[model samples]
Each structure stands twice: as C-alpha cells, then as structure tokens.
Target: MQIPAGPLLQTINSPEDLKKVPKEKLHQVCDELRQYIIDVVSVHGGHFAASLGVVELTVALHYIYNTPYDQLVWDVGHQAYGHKILTGRRDNFISNRKYKGLSGFPKRSESEYDSFGVGHSSTSISAALGMAMAAKYKGETDRKAVAVIGDGAMTAGMAFEALNHAGVADTDMLVILNDNCMSIDPNVGALKEYLTDITTSQTYNKLRDDVWKMLGKLPVGKNFTREMASKLEAGIKGMVTRSSNLFEALNMRYFGPIDGHNITKLVDTLKDLRNIPGPKLLHIVTVKGKGYELAEKDQTKWHAPGLFDKITGEIYKKKFDLPQPPKYQDVFGHTILELAEKNEKVMGITPAMPSGSSLNIMMKAMPHRAIDVGIAEQHAVTLSAGMATQGLKVFCNIYSSFMQRAYDQAVHDAAIQKLPVIFCLDRAGLVGEDGPTHHGAYDVPYFRCIPNMIISAPMNEAELRNLMYTAQLDSTNLPFVIRYPRGEGVMPEWRRPLEEIKLGTGRRLREGKDVAILSFGHPGNFAAAAIRELRAEGIEPAHYDMRFAKPLDEALLHEALLQYEKIITVEDGTVVGGFGSAVAEFMALHGYKNDLKILGIPDRIVEHGTLKELHRECGYDAQAIADAVRQMRKQPVSEMTIPA
Candidate 1:
C-alpha cells in the first residue's frame, strides 16, 4: 500500500502533460495514478471501482484529444476520477469529494477540461451534442466532442433520445459507450442485448470495413461524399449486422466492439477515428471493477468501497456499538418483503437503485416480487401503474432526485388513475458529498402538487416503519410517497409497533407559548435543537412535526396560530413550492395572516458541499433557525412584518 513519491503525479498537472508523455510510458503513469487513487480512496473513500475501470480510457482520451478545446463529457461522472487526476487536479486529488474541495463529478467551474458538468446519469450524449452543434454553428470544424457513457446509463431513455437526436443532427461527435455490463448491477433490457449482439458479431466488422473503404474511395462532391458515404456505409453495415440498426437509423456511424482496457488498441482506434466525419459511436468493452481482484470479483460491493487493505483487498473492519438497525432503505426493503410475504399481490420496483435503495434485499428475500427496471425512471412509474391495474400493491423505491424523471408518469399514470403505489423515496434531503444533482430537495414540492398523492415525511426510523405499514393497510386507493433522508436514522429510545397514524394528522412534539415552529421531514430534528436554543434565550417555541404534506394538519396548524403570535415553518425542500408554501397557502385560504416566516431551500441550484454546510447556507440548520427566531423576537411590535 506504499504510494509512490510525488514526482510522477506532479508531472501530470494537466491533460497537456499527459498528451506530451510518450505512449509507452502510459502504463507506468496509469499504475502511479491507480495507486494514488487507491491510497487516497482507502482513507477518503470515494467511487472506487468506477475510477479503476476507466484508467486506460481516461488516459487514452486525454492523450488523443486536445481537451478544453475538444469536449469530453462523462456520463454519471463518478468514473471521472482518473480524468480529474490527469487534468490539473492531481495535486488536489486527496481532497476529492470532500467539503469545500474538488467535486466527485465533472464540474465546469472546477476546470476548463471538464467542458460540461455532470452528476446524474445519461446526460453526456445530450450535452456533448450541444457542444458539437454549437461548434458547428460557430463554424469551428477542428475541435471534436466526445461522450463517455456507461452501459448502465445507456439504459436511460434520455440517453437514447440524445443518441437519436445526435444521429440526425449530422454533427461530428463521438459517443464511447463504456460497456462494463453493469450500472449498479448488470444492465437490463433489449438494448443491452442489442449492444452485446453488436459486440459479438465478427462478420459485421469485416463487411463494415470493406464497405467503408469502398465508400471512402468513391468521388462524389466533397461535401456530399462524406454524408452519402456515411449513409451508404451505415446501410450496408446494418444489413450485415444482425443486431438492430438503432444508432445507424439515427444517421450516426457505428465503430468498435473494441477492447477498452487495452491502452494501445483504444489509443490507435481513437487516433484513426480522429479524421472521420459525422456522429460516430465506439462501443468499448470494459470491466466494472477492472484491476483489483476483490473489486473484479465483487463489482457491486467495490462500486464504491469503504476503506480497504491494498494487499488482500479486504475492507477495513469496524463493529457497531449497538446492534445497528438496518439502513432506512434496508428497513423499507424488509418491510416490502414482509408485505409481499403476506400478500402475493405486492410488487417491488426500483429505478436502477436496487442496491442503494436496498431493494436488492427484497429481491433476494422475495425474488418473484422484486424488480430492477434499469435506469428508466419514467418507465418504472408507468409500469407500477400498469401493475396496480391488476389490484397489485406496487412499491416503487427511487431516490428523490431521480424521481423527478418520472413526474409525468406520477401524475398521469399513478395519481390520475388513483393507483395504490407506495413510493419509497430514499435520500430525501441534502445528500452529502455527491452534490446538487443527487440532492433530494425537490421531491416534496413535486409530489405535493399531484392530485391523488399523499406525501409523508417520517422523523425517525420507527415512524418510517409505521408509515410504510400504515400505507399498506389503509387501502386508500391512492399513491403514497414516504420520503426519508440518507445515512443513519435517529436512535430514539422509544419503540412502537405498526400503529395506524391518522392519515392527515400531525403530532405535537413540544409545547411552548411565544412562537410555534412547524417542521417537516428530517428538518424536524433541527427545529428541535432550535427550540432548545430558543428556550435558553427565554423564548419558548412550540414545536409541531407535520407528518403529511398534502393533507396538512389544519386543526394542529389552527391551534398553533391561535397560541403563538410568531410562527416559522422549516423543511429541507425548496421554499417556492415546498412545505412552507403549503402552510402559506393554508393560511391564505383561511384568511389567518399572523407573523409567519418560511424557511427551506432557496430558489437556486445549491452546489456541492457538506450537508451541514448546505443546510446552513439554506438557513435550515439549528443555529440559523435559532438566530432567525431571536431576530424576529427583537423586532418592534409596531414594525413586526408578516409575509403575505
């Protein structure tokens, strides 16, 4: 586990330095970079196997293309660590994915080489196409645009849309489909098989090469020749290739089934394709966890490994102080399994987050009841709606941010039809480290507006469990979303069995006189802390935990308004259309306008930072809450302003 001294990585301050290095020395450079990543990640712990898998691809791309000028858009951007190391970030690699440090994803602000910012999946092709189209519009022909997308990301409908659009646009762009046969788990669907068919076809390549050579030799007019040649080449190749001519039909030229790990082959093929025109695709075969034995053997576990020994590749060990309750996601997984166990009609679904959402646990426990529908978020929602038609209870577990992709389906299929689908939304607050694109900030606002949807936020693990149980038994014939935050749940001493919590009722946590603090979701903990601080300052604030967003506790809210002159509503969601806004709407409807303060996420895209930092920035942290209450108390009685 001894890392090499500085000089090797120090020399690679930018992609230019990587380009300057002799190709023969790339293997040594890659070894140094890999070891550096291993050493750094062993302690810091970031996307492990993903970075390992892309070492050669990163090297070859940087070495081949003049980056910053030639765009390199990475899909998902988790595997951009190697690219980061080669592109002026080697010095700060240790600080990667930390608070106030380099981002885990490709950020345009971080470096010029990061041409496009990415965190979510299936955006590279669309973004690269934009860059390509822009380049064409500006009449800049020399520079190229490339998108390095994962096989898992390719399953997303957006990626297909981008591919479809790019093919017809007739712009010169390269899409390197980095096929490791895994997104989180292995990719599914007919497209995966189509890709496999193309990769395995030997005769297709021979026929493609002969046709391409013949097409190149034909002397039509210069401008018309390349277009006509590409069209003819694609047509003949499509006929020879038994696989579906999906990309070719879009008018993009297809290349490769090439070995991605082989540095020489990747570099040589890329160099050859540099002269080719129009949209080109290079389907590269790679291993998800390429180098390390442990990673290679268990790619899923190593996808983002914790601290591990470099030699034996065993993860660093630590025991929990208490018998750790399963992760919130795991609790949901087990609950789903339990529900399915009781009812054969219960179905479990996830949008490519089987492991992250702990749906894999359900899949293992009740394989017949669970399904991972790739990265197709929209598809998962509609599919659940379809399943619900047969009187099945479909529990769809998707991360909060990803759930945005299926908004139309949530409204049209589930909410509109009044389907009994339980949406288990994991990471429903400020998700740490992975940054803004992964933040679960918008789910509350988005799901709240739906007509037949009931949205509930649980304060503790017990409440989460109870909510899920209640949702199952209620037979509401409506869509219910249980939004929960990431990481460890609060260790509350009190325990309760699955009791039916009244559908639209909220419970009071604390009683005080001067002010009322209404909190939603996980932000209730912060409100509690703020209450303690307010008490110390002689301001006793009443605390109410509003469990349901849609069917808000009007009785509890009315009681709070009557008792407290000043009230504040807090949530870990956007202020514009979130919990605070719901309360505001309630007050307006009843014509009860007391001094009200709303606190939540602001109307801007928050950047990558620690959850604590983000919460503080958004004024949802305890200290911020305490300070706001103190400031409100200090305002003169005559000048005390209430928001309309």
Candidate 2:
C-alpha cells in the first residue's frame, strides 16, 4: 500500500506549490517531507540519513530560490532525495533506487530541477560556480547558483581548488556547508577538527544566537539592530571567538553556524542571502539522522542500512544458523589486521572509508598503522608511496571507482617508482543501485596498461586471501592491484592460513576439447555454475581462472588453445581495453588465432540495478556464458590450432 504524503506535502507537486505555502507553516511541510522519506525508504530501501539531515534546507532553498532558473547543485547527491521529492517526483519517489525506477541521486535527465548530475563527492561547488558564471555571461544577473555540500565532502582537495578558483573569478554563488561531522564514518583530519571547533564553541554559538535575538528584541527589529547593534556584536564577538576567516579567506561572504532544522530561520536566512552579491557561504549544522533516534545514535551504520521496519526502526534481516560467507570487504578488513599483526612493515590507508572498506578493523587493532586520509584520494596514494619508499609495506585500500581521482599519483609515485604499494580495490565491478558514476568498470583497463603495475582479481575468498598474502611477501617490489567485487564471498571456510600464489599463473577447473572459458575475478564462479549446466547437456567445456590481468599466463593460455577448438574470455570490467582486451591482444601477438570471444561490460554506460541483473545485461552471467558457448560451437569456425 502506498503511503500518502502529509497535507502540506500533498499540496506540493513542485517548488511553485512549495512557495504557495505560508512561511510560518513551512515547519509542518518539513515534518511531512521527512515522514514521507522515512515511509518510502522503510519499504523501498535507498540512502536514508543524509536526506533526513537536510529536510529543512531542501524546503528553504526551493521556497526562497527560483529553481530550474536559479541553479541548485547537490554535492555527492545522496541528500537530494528531498530535492527530488519536491520537484514533481513525489509520486514516483517510492521507486527510488529500484531497477528502471527513480534514481537515488539528482539526475539532469530526470528533472530540470537537477541543475547538475552528481554521484561522486566534491563536484557541486565547481558545477554550481560554472552555472553561476554561465548565467552571468548570459546577462542573467538575477539568477543564483547554490551548492549544498557536506562538511565531510568539503575536506576534499577538489572542493578547495574550486573555492580558490571561484573566489578569484568572483562567480555569484552560494555554498551551503552542511556540517554533520560524519561521512560514511566519523570524519578524520584537520578540516574535521576545524569544523568541530566552530560548532563546539559554546561561547561563539550563544553569542551569535543572542545577537540575532537582540536584533529582534529592538523595537524596530533586524534592520534597526543591524544599524546600531552591529557595533555591539562586533565588540562582544571580537572579545569571545576568532572570526570565521576560513570561507572569507577564499573571498566568499560566510554567514552561518545556524540550526538547520529551524525551517523558519532557514527560510529567513536564505531570503536574506539570495539578495547578497558575489560568492557566499552558509554554514548550517545538522545531525546526519536528525528525526530518527536510532539513526542519530549510530549514523554511520544507518547511512544505507538495507530494508528496515519504519515504526520499530529495526532492520529487516534473516537469521542464519550456518556460518554465513563474509563479504569481500570484511575478509579484507580481517586479513589486513592479521597481516599487520604478523608483518611489522604492513600499514593501511583509506580515503575516508575506514568503516565502509572495513579498514576500521585494522585501525582498531593497530591505530598507529591504519590511516584514514579524509576524502583525499590523490593524497592517500602518494602517502602510501612515501611510506613504501621508507621500506614499509602499505595496503592502500580504495574503492575502484574512486581510484579514477588518484590515477596520476598511482602512475607517477607508485608504478613508475616500482613502489610495493598494495592497491586493494574494493567494489571493482558493477556496484548496483548507486549507478554509473559509482561503477568499478574502468579500473582494470585503466591500470592494466601502466608499466610495473600487476593487476590481479580473485575468483573466491580463498583466492583473495592467497593473493593478499602473496602480494605482501618480502620478494614483492612492483605496485600490485587486487580487484574484488561488492558482495559476500563464496568460501565460508575463508579463515584458512594465507598461502602465497605463484604470480602470472592460472588454475584449470575443468578439461574439455570443444571450447575453453577463461574468467577473471568472481565471474569465474559464474562460469563454474554455467559449466555444470553445460555438462548436463553433454557440453563439457574447460574453465580456467585467469588470476592476473597484467602478466597474462601465456603458458596456461597456450595449453587451453592447444586443447580446445575455441576460446572465450570473460571479466566483470569493460570490454574496451579491459581484461578481455588484454587476452585478445596477447592471442593476436602470439598468432594463436583460434576463434576468440570477449565478454564484459559493453563500451557504454550501464544504469543502476541488482548485481545479477547487471551481469546478465552485460552478457557475462552463467546463462549468458552458456548461451555464448552454445552459439560459438554452432558457428562454422574450425578449431583454433597453435602455430607449432
């Protein structure tokens, strides 16, 4: 059953409808909006906490600014659910993050209200500034561009770079600093401390609030207060706290440290700020999970807590008696702790994903060694290289998609110098629901061509353990990349002793004469399932787990080509310049012209869906593998023979 939006929210179909509601009644509207989000997310399951944090801000922005004309860019966009709901998508909001349904984040194609599409963090300021500059160029001085970025996102180098550029360029832009003091995990480093110091200054907040209150207390209210009481504020505040010189130093007028949930105050502040000229900053403090007690208590865990009971706030979960297979990330977290415990040189680094990547496990065990670098990917990579130069073994764990940010650092500092930086790339394939920007499709192809880089993907938990073990061996020197997928691993007995795997070698699972299927990473498990079905049809094709994409196992590949009539290479990465492309290149170079088929992500963008659905669409699922083999066998191509 579909839940109805509250009376105030029901009247709102667009921002135009939102503006019709009296300013005094906006709090009721925010309440309705927040409930609607909880109701829908309780059933449909999408990002929860971030959107909940910005309910009042979303309402205030739409109510104050002329959206679709005055641009609004949401940084990272996880918090844009409320923005989406207010902008004619309320009816379809329940379909958020579902396959072929409403996208979880703001999308330009989805709505005119979404001025810029966003998924990755720290792009909003730049995007909004560009729009602001474009509007100025077009002589539309009345229009405004606002970027609502979290304090966590503000820690990124891109955000600072944009601030530096925008400050000098003098773009008419507003940046909303949503300080919740958390991003997936509790934020780390100097910026976090700085933001915390501002928010925690009891004297500063009380003085600022009292000044605004005193302005209202004057018989003439704010205008009169600004005229006369401004001197008093300057006099008192100067004695108490250091001024907010941070945003001002970047040449943007900063106004805030205000309560985010106060809809009336938000509206009033926004109304005032809209009239201001040049770049401006509004620092609004919000709790990550404001309305809900459970999420507020444990914000990081609730960031994207799957499906949950809305009323009780209990996550819907299955109880299992049998030991469940650990997620690839958990295995990594546990393995790293074990490795660091044994090897004194082992150190871990992550770019603000201590909890998400499970590096928190190692950080807990060895706080000094495991470092959280606070949304700075390029810095994380270079820091690892610097550490590696000092003969320390560094496991630089980063999301595969996020590595796109630090590619240059990886090439110059790690690969070129042959630093033994163990790059454990989690989420290396289709990351379902988060969509194209978050997909780990490009990492394999992007890094494979880099010299002195060893690219390896494990087929299961056991192989992943072995690969991590093998990479950390004292003999290892070159930079190594271990790519793995998102979900649970197949091996329940994954806690076995870590054994070193021979580099550039593959293990054959089955033997056949007709065709040989080569697979890399977790996709080999899919191939194994297909092999069983093929055998049931008396189609016994051979299977080989090609562990490494960089150093192609020419000996094993030659062995397969000599035995089989055809060859098929499958990977979860892109077909263009990926693992499959590497295989094709090697086959052509060696003059082994046996009929070859490459299967992977097609050379186009794939939208959000379940992992299995995406795999099937990309034609690498078990059924797709079976169909490919059957089709290849039916073709009138002769068996490939080695040029002996």
Candidate 3:
C-alpha cells in the first residue's frame, strides 16, 4: 500500500528543494501534500486534521524562509506533519508515530529543519525569542526566527510572558498566530473571544486594510525605513481604534487576519514580514481542517481519528465480540457528573482539557460548576484552591504530564493551605504514541514528598469510582490525588455502586506461599496477569494492590513482609522516588532485609510506542514480571532479618 505523493511534492526533498518549485505550482504542492497526508494517515494513523489545516502555511513558510539556518519553531507540534513532509521526510512519512519510527511532532534530533522540539503548548514564542536573541548576539544579521503558535496555545500565561519580553527585546522574530479556533478542543477564554471579535469585526478589518494600503504606498529606501513605518502604523492604530488589537498593544507590529489558505497571499505576506525587522505577529485565519469537509464539520473528533476510511470519511474502530471496558477518562467524566449531582460542594476544573480529562461530561451537565480554564494549568490549581477555601470540593482534573506546569500552585496554593482539592490525574503513565514529552512518568515522585497530599492510584474502574467517592467526602480533608493510566480499565461491568475506600489502606488480592508482588494503579492488572501465568507454571506468588503511595499501609505491609521471603514492587511511574522506592523506604525503616526487586518505568526517556510495547521494553509487562518471579524462584531466598 505505497501511497504516491503528488508529482510536485515528490520533487521537494527540503526547503531548498521547495524553493526550486515555481510559485505557481505551490498550490499543486499544497494539494498533493494535503492528499498525501490523507492517504498515509488514513492507514498509518497519526494526528490527522491539524496537519491538514496547516498545509498551505507550511509551504509558504518554507518557501519564504531559509530554514534550519533561519529558526522555525512549532508550538505544540500538532501542525508539524506538513512541515515534516516538505522537509526531506516524504519517503519515511508513513512511519509517523510508529514504534522505532518517526516522531509524531517536530523533533530536533530527527531533522535539522525542526529548529525546536515541541510537544507541550505555549512554548513557541519563548523558544523562538531565545533563538532570535542568540542570532543577534552571534551577529547573524540575516537570520530570522519564526514561531507558529495556535490560538488555543495563546490562552496560556507563558505566551503572554514571552510576548511581553519579545516586545522590548528588539529581536528579529515573527510570531505567526495560527487562528484555527481549536486545540484538541475548541479554544476558550477571553483571548478566544478577543480573537473572534478581531476576525469578525468588518469595521476593524476594513480600517486595518486601509491602514495597510496606506503604509504599503509609503517610500521604502533611506527616507522611509521599517521603524518609521512601524511608528506610523502604531500612531494610526492609536488614533483610530485606541490600539484595540492585543498584539499591537504588546509593542509588536501586528499584521493580518489574512487568508492562511491562500498560498500566494501567505507567501507574499511572509516575504514582506521577513524584511520588516523587530518582534512582530502575523494573525492568519485558517480552518482547523481546511481541505477535508468531514473534518471541517467535526474538528474535535477528527483531530486524531485513528485509521480512518478517507474516502468514506468513517473512523475505524476495532469490532469487539463482547462489550469492552470504557476508557478511564469516560468513567471519570461520568463519575464526576454523578458526584457533582450528589454533592452541591463538588466543582470541576481542567486546564483547557475538559474533553481530554472527561470533565466535559460534568461541564455539559453543570456548566457553571465545571470550567475549562484555557491552557492555564496554574490558574486551574489556584482557582480550585480558592473554591476550596469556600468549603467547595474542587476536582482539578489534569493530564499527569500537563500537571508539571501547575506544580507550584499545587504546592503553594493547595498543599500548603491543605485545601481538600481532589486532583484527578488522567493519563498517568506511558501514554502510547505521544512519547516522553507526554508521558505521566514523574507525578508520583514529584507529589510524594509534598505534605498534606494523599497520593493514590486505582487498580481498576471500581476502585477509581471508590477513590473518587472517598476523596469528596467531608471526612477526607487532605489534598487528594487519584492518578490513573490512559485507555481502558480491566473491568467491563465497571459501573459499580460508589463506596468510600478508607484512607491509608491496601487489599491483598491473592495469597501465596513465598513471594509477594506489591502493585500500584493500572499496573496491578499486569501484576495479576503475571501471577496467573506463574501459577500455571506451579509457582504461586501473592499480590497486593497498595492504593496509596503517600500513606503506606503499614499493617498490610507488615503482614506481607512477615509471611513472604521475596518481595517485588511494581508501578507505571519511574522507579526513582516512586511507589517502589516508597516500599523500599518502608522496608529499610523497619529493618526487614527481604529479597526485593522493583519493576517500573526506568529513569530514562522512553520513546513513543503502544502501551504494551513500552511496558515490555521497560521490563514490567506480564511476561517480564513472570520472568522476574521465575528468576527469583531459581535463587534461594536470603534469610530474612527483622529487628526484635
């Protein structure tokens, strides 16, 4: 199934090669590239609509800029697919997001054209500014730094911070605001509303056009320079609309609300901006799914619609003979709504990830109670703390990786105040295909040391429901964390009656003779499977699902330690300072010198792949666990030493 690129696209191996294509043929190139993306992604399965959206812009940027030398940074990397294809990766494009293949995002190691590696949002402006500043310092007068950032990413405070500095920095940089009105979900907040107002206002646009026309006609040599033009533009903006545009007010010359899909227009606009020095912004309006009709209608669903029928416009799903368990996120979404219905005090908050965290369910049912705080993770945490001060239970749902952004707020605002903020950390493991930048690998270690934080993980959906039930109770008055992995849980019939799980407790799932496997979170299922496999080989190992990492179940641990001679701890998080480390600490504190082994994500950058592949690669999958037990069985257990 070799997908053929358009004849024009086939000629482009790099931006240098793209520069060779006649300007008239760029539209054909865009069409070919867009069609190629559709053809390959329909079968290979990577991010779909975002790449499709930016095809024209990607071509325009490469054509105008001397890339690799001239730095170009993509904010979140969702739209970098077209960029990659144009830059010598056309042949290997099918390997996108596959195991041991191309990264889904723009990666610096992967290509010289990828000036900055990005996975998280709202980082492009700052990163590009740095590159521009470096070029200035190095006296590279002709060099330019361009950042392609989305409207959704603009909602984050970090973007504003960078814009504030970039305004006065006097650097040769361009911030291309890709206003698609979406980032996985629809863009929210005042910024979104402001962008809408700018794009929609006929009066503003007409005046803007007149101003641009007047500025264009001004003399261009020594008498009238770029600075003079900038000042004149600023003066006109101040006099007419009181400088209504946000980017203009930041002291950066702002151009556009231009048609991003018009390849010629984009090329012309970018060429002109390259000559106009200082920090500037180009606000180009484009649809999230520009060429695809189905994607344009339903942008969110088509964002990453995995292995679709491109012709039929049907997203493929694996047909199951029996009912499969729902994703943990969906369960969280429904359960949070259920909890909100029961408790008037319960409110939901997510940092522009209501849909991702499944809090969208609650948002739909109780709009006022649940909020999408744009891309402001810190604001979400602090806002949750504020609500907690009023005795309201706020479940601040965030992706485990994204929560790293709000660590300060979690510590200073919530944990220090001991606000009973229930932090539901979704995708709290090696999230498949997203790679290291998105893996929820450090949450356990990061949060474990914080006092007044009750860190817990659920073994399955029932346990997750129970944990949520417990965390919201008035009796539970700590900053609670319930971290769960991505994708489906083990139980199909998981809509169990919500019951409160006692704090600082664990349950022994299986009782065996010599060895005990201490498991945490979703990886408990892996441990159970390994135990089953070992049992078939006439080796029975005990298993315990220790729900809480912060508060070790000393009684249960004591029971296991006394009976079992060999102990193995398993967690989806990093072994360093994680649940396994916590267990090791407990063992060390009590002076129990039993044979111990820890299995989890090693302290290294794990690349993108399927969850099963990552688990096996990290040596914690069922077979790996079973192998560990068998290896331990072969060696006689060391004599256990306990303090009297």
TM-scores, all candidates, are 0.91, 0.96, 0.97
Give the Cα-based TM-score of candidate 2 against the true structure: 0.96
* Clash pairs detected, candidate 1: none
Order of quality (lDDT): 3, 2, 1
Task: For candidate 3, write residues 507-570 as lDDT tens digits.
Answer: 9999997889999999999999998888888899999999999898999999999999999999
After superposing candidate 1 on the true structure, give the runs of residues whose Cα lies further than 4 Å from its correct spot. 1-7, 200-241, 317-320, 492-496, 532-539, 636-644
lDDT of 2 by residue, 1-644 (tens): 66789988998999999999988888899999999999999888999999999999999999999998999999989999999999999989877887888888899888999989999899999999899889889999899999999988988999999998889877789999999998889988888887777778899888888877867767866556454665676555457655455676788766778899999889989999898788988999999988988999999988999889988988998798998899999999999999888999999999999988999999998899999999999999999999999999999999999999999999999999999999999999999999888899999988988999999999999899899998988898899999999988898888998899888888898888688999999999999999899989989889999999988898998888777778898998999999888888888788777888999899999999889888988899999999999999998776454676
Question: Best-fitting candidate, measured by TM-score?
Answer: 3
Q: Over the stretch 230-346, how does candidate 1's per-residue lDDT look in tens digits?
A: 667666666777443676667767777778888988898999887888899888999877778788888889988777877878788678776654467767776777777877787
Candidate 1 has what TM-score?
0.91
Candidate 2 error regions (>4 Å)? 210-239, 638-641
> lDDT for model 3, on a 0 to 1 scale?
0.91
The residue ranges of model 3 lying beyond 4 angstroms of the native Cα positions read: 214-232, 235-245
What value of lDDT does candidate 2 attain over all alpha carbons? 0.90
